[model samples]
Target: MAGGTDAGAGAAAEVPGLVGVPLLGSLFDLKSDSLGTYLRAQHRHGDLVRVTAGPPGMRAELYCVFSPEGAQQVLASEAANFRKDNAFYQEVRDSFGNGLLTSQDEDYLRQRRLVQPLFTRRRVDGYAGAVAAETASVIAAWDKAPDGVVDVSDEMTHLALRAVARILFGTDVEATAEAVARCFPVITDYVLRRGYSPANIPRHWPTPGNRRAAAAMDELYGVCDKIIAERRGAGAHTAGRGTAAQDGPVQDDPAQDSAVPGGAGEDLLTLLAAARSSDDGEFDASELRDQVLIFLLAGHETTATSLCFALHLLARHPEEQDRAREEISRVLGDRTPEAADMDRLPYLTRVLKEAMRLYPAAPVIGRKAVADTRIGEHTVPAGADVILAPWVTHRHPAHWPDPDRFDPERFTPEAEAARPRYAWFPFGGGPRACIGQHFSMLESVVALAMILRAYEFEAVDTEIPVGAGITLRTDGPVRCRARRVDG
Candidate 1:
């Protein structure tokens, strides 16, 4: 929140940058194609390029960090010096509530501590059953597809939403899933538009956009709140006798004993309802809604993106697809896949990893420099808005040769060990990394293994244009023809 000291200010060399039109700079270019802008900036201006836009008083200077080394410095090594104090993040926090993804400083620390246990490897693996069930449902539904053609994008999105909803709400999943499907697009689109805009009309104003976003939020919040209330009521019936609240937190085994009345026992909602810390008590109803909302937003969309792209890539490359399918068949024959199958099916994991390498969910990560920090040879002054782009860093020529190629071999254990830790950070790195990392991977590997096992895909749409939103998004349907593997 403070600026760089006067002592360091004069000596700090200016970062090499892209100078666009006078006053406006590169704002329009960035707005039009941020991913392209990031790539061009890295290729033409090197990793640490300054990209400024807007007129004098409203100008925004983006200190872009594109190299693996620089990404590490900003996101991991010198992470404390780079805080999530940017406008985009603030907008997210306001829209979604200060849950783990948007919370900072002590609040982030507290949220992480409270939410960590729920996402542990042991706990996340438990959700694989849910993922398998959801994936099976999707695979079965493909039987109705006309001529066995399906949109990988739409299908994966639906599958992921169902999977996460089932895990999060359990028996109440049906109640929450449709609402999330209907409202999330409205909310995320609103966040993106307002987040990038230089200025925005006050949300309270009766503008059409504001009214629409408000209605969507109300519907979304209303549904989630009703479920939370019902879950609490059910918990009270089971544990509190006639009282509305539980006696206290489930201290002995919060993860296991947190089940409520309807057999939604180990679902994330129950866990959050029962989550407690020595210093901090359990989440209140409002807090619970916030955490659930954030999880739904982050959980489904990211894995769906990874699954869509992975299937599309495999559809486009049959030989690679065959190799991955062979591995799946060898490892899991005539049976549903589970989380434990992840290590046994290493090649499939590599396929998913390679897909993430190409199409990372969160492409452009933002931060504000908390102090004068040296990145590579450039000094990013305190208070400067910084961008850590995984989309660019994952494809950095120094780290990834033939970066544009879709080769799962790139993620082989040996190849991965040889590369910089930050070179292929699709889940990001450091303390503030995604809390649901294991859940995401577990869901993806299990779902992908099953889907690949069910169908042999041939890409109908060989190419998909993408744009950056809250996550990487496709501009058009990623279509593929699915023939039954048995046939």
Candidate 2:
């Protein structure tokens, strides 16, 4: 087994001079929102500190080994030793089934490979027009009521949901959007509650929240099933028929049989229907349905949360926001940005990066050690839960100077090069890093550019409450006043 430091060779090096109560060690302080208390303990106790929670064997620990060397050791050098912990995965599994985020080992790898291509730059870029169109529509709607206070969070949620729906299902997303939206609050609320209490109860004897969550999940899945059925039928209709390669019906093309290699690119449903296993195995309809549901559920909400935070930050920091808007105007005068234009929007990119750094959509990523391993100088037990928190690490003063300040300059190419590789992990790290990262980034940039070009946003309130569950978000509604930019 590996170890961080050898204070005295054979013993689990007790943190130097740090004291804790018999039970309920640091839980009270932690729950009371004392980040400094925990951070101070880390500073005083060295790299690793262990403290008992509410009960014996209910221990909580903190590890400050988040440097590039430590991140490489945990994420790459000894990755096999880590797996999703039961406590964390249980909550995600209960809500999302064994989707990419919750699945582990072989299953996770397989699903990831299959889904990876969908998030490639080419594929993601393909949706640029859809993103721009949807964002424009939302902005237009907002323009209708300039004087009224707008709940920007709600606006972002709807906009992101619509954009993702178009990308995944193609055309007329109204019904599906309604179904998914109906279930979102329930899923979000349940996930948040489970974080505080990591126990399981029978679904049949559900609490009111659980019952609603379960029902919402069922309803959402029902919508996915219907979409899959429709696509499957379409696939069947096109399977045997010889269709034209381009600009004509399948039956009309000269080389119809060989024209379109594999699946059609018309929509996500078509892609999934045509997607075949590398081993020539066919995807069952249910698997396709589950995957579609996973994409919609996971993709939209996370992006929405991040965008909401980004808007709030921009409104608060007007100079940064102005810089971003100026860059957008310079790059794209009156034209909507195409995929190629993303490369030119440096300030907008920085704004998005800084926003995500402050409030990562998925704040913490955790894994359970499968075998004894040394992370830095600490000897992690085989079953110990290891957590790498972007929320915490992204703001670590050692890694980032004046980390709390909303500074987009930190993301400049020169500034970025100066930092450690793993110092800013807004989308996580290693082989399990988000496949849709580029896609999400592209979408965010485009959406922000469109909004900025159309409106000048001002903070309606100075004080905004923040909270975190699956994603960091404003506790109450975030209202902003948007004045249309002068022509």
Candidate 3:
């Protein structure tokens, strides 16, 4: 089916929305409860629904698509008609600049080509041992702690940060880890908060929140710059991994061998430093820093957030946890999980898919209509905002039966293949989907295997407190009782 709907001459009709109170529109509603308000609008309206936000002068209409067909239309079919220059990307670029996530057109293509090799399947798999090591390093701290409540959210956050820090920047970034951990949340939260708000204040204005965000950004970028400076300045020095090492294993890319500079290093900063264009040009300081910042911030935070939810879901559903643990026990036993073992652990993979389906780390994918476009039969005006919510779409009863239940079997090969492509896009779809998705999933699977194998998690609360931001995050923290496992 073409986008799962047949569009006709009615393309000029206006998309539906509430004629809200005078100037406010849905500003208060979205600001107060974005996730709730968004889902409700989709249910009450239809798959392709319209929601308004902001005051009269700055009134904005957003098209929220919950149908896979609609998602395919914007993300795949007519993707070129949409651009990433939406409010969300604009604000986020404050931290990411023109990195892959924010860059478009030729810039995006070039940078994507340069950075794509780092996340190739073979490379990511090679990094698995490192993922396990980093995760082991953080969770090991908890092994000796007294039995009590730990914010597993905080735990995963630290684990994911340290894992990405070393994996991407190598051991040298270990010193910058604490500072980056402290600062990035501020910067990212600020960017996300602004992205969701209907009314946006100017960054040039000295707002307290903006000032705090700016300061956090400085600290965040300072760390990135330090890593870049150190990597480039050292000539051939890397923490421990030599220049000859590939970031992972060389998969299929011929560019990998030559893309890297003189076999000096393969950590992200080193690779970027070594990366040369067809023109034999190296990135300037700003260009290099931008890519690092995106990887460092987006790389860790999104996975950490997903990991936090996955652990929480398993904690609440002991049966699912037990099933997954059984699989881990069978495949991994008392041994640690390596990337090579991933394909052997099918059930563990399903558990992750189900968890992400319920609580997608990136709940909404935002785009702007660059030209008038037809989403289904409706004409979306140029400059209008388009939002695809994996949060809502993943729960749509049309595609998913028992939408709220914790069921991993839905992700089994037979079941997943039965659904449409965009029906369960946790990392998004089409060309602009998350570049680090493979890397993120591998990190999560490795961490999950290790955590399940070593510990038993008891939920302190049945209700999950969720907040929407640069990524979906638990409002305060996801607390659980942790007890180390014994053979």
Candidate 4:
């Protein structure tokens, strides 16, 4: 492929120089509505477009290619040249340390090898029961209210947090749910705002929202630390000692309880404790702490946002909602769905897929090129930021017919097989793809099935505006009425 060559076949006309002003070039337009701006850029410029930002004229490139050939090249063929951008990684590192989400290259490879097994299909399936039980408990609590309006975002956040707490921490932690909820806006706000502003402020400084976020993070970590302490205290004495250490007296530190025998605990913390690296190295306390924070934020918030949007979509499109309900009813009959039933609920899965396509939780995945690379006919300079947007790709007319329309059939095996591999990347693609993809899919299937089996959703406010930050969400509360369904 010739760099800078106009491959006129599927290319839009290239604009000379970068789009937007220096220091803030296209930043406002990009941030205002990411998907819309991306589409416009692709239509106006070409598959590859240049954007400038920062005071010293830092330039980045955006690609909105829906072609199978282009998608494959970026996501797979030239993956080595592309890596997560420093700005995004720095934000996560500030919050999560150098855990899996923020770690690069060799560190990422090592962490992934150790953590990948935990998300295997079998292990992910094990979490279905916990997802179902948590969904049921949440619905049961909601049943106490009589035909009232509920904020779907708030409700979903609470449900996801509770589910993660029960399954990942082995502690209900219901009392702290309110406190945890308060932390998200602050965290999200700081992250999004900092992306545009160049100033770097320490978390310890008494800034308004930053201080609250720091406190909330402390509260969140405090809960995890307490759980770790409890487990360590219980498991310390019985923890296995190697044959060479038989002569030594055992220390009474509760922290050693993480080394307990038999892998007895159900919490993710315990699993992390018991998990050994492929090379047999164990995660130390700090590593374990960083992972806990990463999982807590990544596991719940995105799933919660997706579920909220799914419900909102169902509310607006009654026919699709009916199909989902019918599928749930027929698949499970009268019993609650188990892991085995997930494979049988194809329509439910399709509905969730379409929901994610229409309203992706994480709108875009970004990368920075480490070396000069040619994508199609364009030679992207080293240090240029590259973005793969699910929000834009899922709505691209070239891949999806009536791209803006909400249709579940697009996810049917035949329909899905017809599109490019990266055409509908809600959770991303390739080696660095989301490790929790299966887990999130299973969680959504089980939760949506359980909800549909009991109630029919109706839209109370059809005009609710969509918003974005870490996840695509409703601007205001998603008010909806849930009517009981006859069994």
Q: Which candidate is the best by lDDT?
A: 1
Least well predicted 10-residue stretch by lDDT in candidate 1: 236-245
**Cα distance off (Å), candidate 4, residue 276:** 1.1
Worst 10 residues of 4 by lDDT: 241-250
Those runs of model 3 whose alpha carbons end farther than 4 Å from true positions after fitting are 1-13, 144-146, 197-201, 236-264
Q: Per-residue CA lDDT of candidate 3, range 215-247, in tens?
A: 888877787787778777887333223223234
For residues 1-487, what per-residue lDDT tens digits would candidate 4 score against the true structure? Answer: 3333223424533433446775667767766766677667666665666655445544434544434455555567767777776576677777666778778788787667666655656656767777877898888876766675667788888889877766666554564455556765676677777754556677677888778778767776676676667766776323342211111222333333323222246555666665663353666667767777777777888888778878888988988899888888777888878778878999888888888988888886677777766566566556766766667677777788888788888988999888778787777677777788887888888898888788778888877666556667567788788877875
Higher lDDT: candidate 2 or 4?
Answer: 2
Error of 2 at 230 (Å): 1.1
lDDT of 1 by residue, 192-256 (tens): 99989888888999999888989999999999899889878887224421112233342334434
**How accurate locally, in lDDT, is each candidate?**
0.84, 0.70, 0.78, 0.69
> Which pairs clash inside model 1?
259-265
User: lDDT for model 4, on a 0 to 1 scale?
Assistant: 0.69
Better of 1 and 2 by TM-score: 1
Model 2: CA > 4 A from native: 1-12, 15-22, 29-47, 57-65, 146-148, 236-265
Per model, state how many residue pairs clash: 1, 9, 3, 1
Query: How many clashing residue pairs, candidate 4?
Result: 1
- Give the higher-lDDT candidate: 1 or 3: 1
RMSD score of candidate 4 (Å)? 6.3
Q: Positional deviation of 38 in candidate 4, in angstroms? A: 1.6
Candidate 1 error regions (>4 Å): 1-9, 236-263
